[model samples]
Target: MRRLLEGVVPGELLLHYLSLLARGRLSVEEAPGLLDGAGNIDALIREGMAYCHGDDHSMLVAASPDLVLQRALARMAGHLAAEHQRLLDGQERLRAIQAPTDATAGGAMDQLVQILTDGGKIAELTLTLAGSAQRDWLILGARMAADASDATSTSANCRALYESRCVASAGERESVEAVIRAGGMVRLAPRVGMSMRLADEAIALLPLSERNPSGALLIQSSVIVGALREYFELLWERATPYGVPDVEEGPLPPIQMKILRLLVQGLSDTVVAERVGVSVTTVGRHVTAIREALGVQHRFALGVVAVQQGLVE
Candidate 1:
């Protein structure tokens, strides 16, 4: 729900379609396309809601795509042929209802027919990503495009959190902070070697390389997601919370504040001195004072504490 609403659609949608297909009630082709707009997303969402309520029929019947969409679905037959028989069985079951059609039957029957005829293009896209060796690149491009187009991607009812290690390049740092400023609760991890990101329930695992050229795997299975959520909570427990204060508490002297800010940027002591127009000895003194004042043992920890306490921008 987090990833889908937050615009991590390709992975989440693929996971959703796979789960639905696994149910044996529908095939991949029977699923509506991802780029089918809010109409299909809404349909799938309704199906999910119905599933939650144990009313399988509502989902099976409410999302019948029209004839043209069905025709498009037929072209997906090559990949979806395996499920044809099971779907036919379901249709036959529907047909066996000799009783008078209830108010819901008409709508549900149409949806079932639609599902039989539907195949989502977005699902196909994610499938390609899933099998590709270079999926992360494609997924990243898709996410960037979605980010550009979506103005209201986040859900108001949900809490948003991010853990950044600040090892990202300067430009990437700005972007991360922009996301944090936009309703995200940011934290600083002590260190990280993995290339990963989580959007709601979806977890994107990229190659460990700095550039992450190989691709990414977006997993949304319940077991994996739930476990990952627990792991995230554990990591969060050890992370330093980042809440950029409107006003720096205790108001360190202007020079000390400058030093902390540069240090968080991963600046060296010499560079910090150059930037602040202070001598190396003076910069070291301030660094030591900042650490002691924050009750942290080292400058690295001081930087983390500074960001957490909003002592540094």
Candidate 2:
């Protein structure tokens, strides 16, 4: 041990001891034990002296356990300071590179549209809603919300404007009803502040940051809106009419199921007739029969009820 300390105890040995200290091998009271023993004291003294080489000069002069701990902390602080400074410098450089390119113009809406059209990034957020009916409103509101959402997206796809249409037809509403009845969530805020328009759908909602409203950042390319539309149809199907009585779930036959499936898939009576190998008049007869069976006022309602009843599988 004496011979090991004669020339200089290596940095590896000092690092090993530091690692032990870091790992709780030496408790606070046990630090004094490190200074005890015949050859141990000399070994430590020699190791302390050997710290003089390169950048370890300050560590060698640090006397006492506190002083040694402070030196080690100072080295750590210096390393962290360098890393922090590098991050700051890189951030500053990126800002300098980007600042000149971001030129947004016009009113809030126009500027928003310009920014989106000119290449703005889309932000996605998860929003919580109020109630099931409000959930209905929110679904309706997304059509209204589409324009506002589009203006927020960067490099907003032109098709996004068309895609933004909130197509919550009676058929779609049925889908929403189904989802809600199935224990899926749907909600909306009764009071919306800002108005949004994307083609046929329009939504007005208070700014999300201020209050619980209908507005949110929408991504047209993303399936969320489409999925929401499908969900709306589900709910619309199962939801009782707002002013009307709750209708009973009536029985639908397998033939009605086949007819409803074709209708829901956007097939016209003539096309359905061709597909079913029946005449158009025969298809009409089946449609009338299905509508009567479902007790719906219209063919659209018939489609909705059929879907809700699982007639289309």
Candidate 3:
């Protein structure tokens, strides 16, 4: 009952009941039962008045009149909390999607031609190019078209083409950060590498890459663009939005991540003890803590789980 009072306040219970209605987790006819029935409410109210219990009476009245009315209206509206969340998520998705612009077939320049021919297209575009001379040449040509006064493309939306970021080592992460800071965009798997800050107007790879003769596959369709935008947005949402720290040589201290990094470097408890300036026993304590945190029964399994979770290089 103490724990119940701490967590499940009467007001909160009222809100949860309303949320159930909104979430379609509750039904209207069942409201009387959930509210402990009109007869029970009346009996409680009578007891409250007899004992001069103002608080209990207030609770009973609010639950009876306010909650019952709110729940009834919510049921009529067919409110379901899950459905409301979907509508909200859909709105967020729509905000991220660049409106569909005409992307016609003139090879790599199809998107460019479509935008120009349609006119008044002001959506941000992300272009990926392979590390080839022909693709570079095509990028140059596209830049020229983008420079035209009649072009609807905004200079703010045009970002630098970037290679996929590889996270084989911390040094590579530093290089990737430099490129991203210099306005480069990367295509990466969600949760593959260490999280990095990114620009808003970015691109992500589809489940499959498109094949083209020009060596640079132009992406302009709204559905594909929207999907990529959602992925980048998901990464951006999960990533440290601003004030990211620079890459350091060693892992940050006092967490399972730090212990796992040391383990990955082939350091035993004794060697790790000297390096981290803790005693062997203390290092063993850390190892125990890490194993327990990761729920692994053995030391060897710790490394396997750390690698899989991307806690180590």
For candidate 1, lDDT tens digit of each residue in 62-144?
Answer: 22224323433454564488588789988788656622452221234323111111123223323333333221111121122
lDDT of 3 by residue, 210-234 (tens): 2211222334455654554554455
For model 1, give the 10-residue run with minimal summed lDDT. 134-143
Q: What is the model-wide C-alpha lDDT for candidate 1?
A: 0.44
Off by over 4 Å in 2: 1-15, 18-64, 104-313
Span of ten consecutive residues with least summed lDDT in model 3:
132-141
- How much RMSD separates candidate 1 from the native structure? 24.7
lDDT of each: 0.44, 0.40, 0.38
Residue 309 lDDT (model 2):
76
**What is the C-alpha lDDT profile of model 2 across 1-313, one tens digit per residue?**
3233222334545544454334433333443355344244345445442222234322222233444544556666888999999999998887566456634211233121122222122112211111111212232333332223322221111111111122247654554333222222233333322322221112122224324333333323224444444544454454432211224433543444566789989899899878877656446655764665577878777657766777654
Taking every candidate in turn, the Cα RMSD to the unseen true structure, in Å, is 24.7, 19.3, 16.4
Q: Order the candidates by lDDT, highest first.
A: 1, 2, 3
